[model samples]
Target: MAKLLFQRVADEARPPAILGRPGCGPPDYFTEVLLDDLVKSGAWLDLELKRPFLALWVNDEDFDFPDWNDPLIAIDQANVRKFAAMDPVVDLESLRGMRVYHDEPYFR
Candidate 1:
């Protein structure tokens, strides 16, 4: 399902704002679920190392994602600038506007 969605974005060039936090499907299973699809579909996926956030884009214009306003979420200086250059209007002052899930550690 996620692969098909991303493939559609790649095919049509309409990138949506993809956001998530700790436990939800996105930031949680990003590496596990989305990376392969993004790569296979030939779309761009910018993974944030510090914080669990990522952006998807096929073209420079349709790029979209949230900015935590906190440096912890930014990958690096150059990467930050690259995202800024892609779409200069995606300014997210806080993650309050996005759908986030609190993750609880599972102990066995």
Candidate 2:
């Protein structure tokens, strides 16, 4: 079940799809600033992911900020095999299992 779900997210988050490109290619920029906005705007739902679990250090007062280190950004095998394959520059394997903390912070 998890494999199928991961594959679905991998398919949806391809750079072209996320960047609204008409053809295959990486985007000119993959910036953390943009990523932060995407997180706060809940744009990742375009990939069908729920709002991510927040980190303990994330200030509740920092409503405008979303931690890039959040598990929502964690790389999995499905992403490595699908989305990450498009970029040769990234060492996707080394990024696996990088969650610094585990456990959901807030209840929806």
Candidate 3:
């Protein structure tokens, strides 16, 4: 029963819409799911660590900021420089397990 429900949820779930600027590649469905789970589990804060730098999503409702580290631009950038300089495919796959931060401070 639990397995059936999990499958159902997975099937019904749609990837989060990527808005604003164009992204470098296809939508990261796995990252979206992990982000959702982190939000639900209360393990995520507003700040996310993409790699070497820290960043906060500008407007999660409309768009997700490119993941990055302090002194780093994008997660892809850090990954490329540090890990997958020669293999893009491998770098993309590695992104799935990266830490995603949420619950950023909101200003009115």
| Candidate No. with top TM-score | 1
lDDT of 3 by residue, 1-108 (tens): 122222222333243222211343334333433333333333322111322111122222222444445332353334333322221113334344344433212111
TM-score for candidate 1, please give it. Answer: 0.24
TM-score per candidate, chains pooled: 0.24, 0.21, 0.22
lDDT of 1 by residue, 39-75 (tens): 3334343322111232322222323453656453333
Worst 10-residue lDDT window for candidate 2 reads 50-59
Give RMSD (Å) of candidate 2 vs. truth: 15.7
lDDT agreement with native, every candidate: 0.33, 0.30, 0.30
Each candidate's clash count: 0, 0, 8
Task: Tell me the spans in candidate 2 whose CA falls farther than 4 Å from its real position.
Answer: 1-79, 100-107
User: What value of lDDT does candidate 3 attain over all alpha carbons?
Assistant: 0.30
Two-way lDDT contest, 1 vs 3, winner: 1
List the pairs of residues colliding in candidate 2.
none
TM-score: the better of candidates 1 and 3? 1
Per residue, candidate 2 scores C-alpha lDDT tens digits across 8-102 of: 33245433123222342233222222343333333333412211112111223332354547654342222322332332223333443434333
What is the C-alpha local distance difference test score of candidate 1?
0.33
RMSD to truth, every model: 11.9, 15.7, 15.4
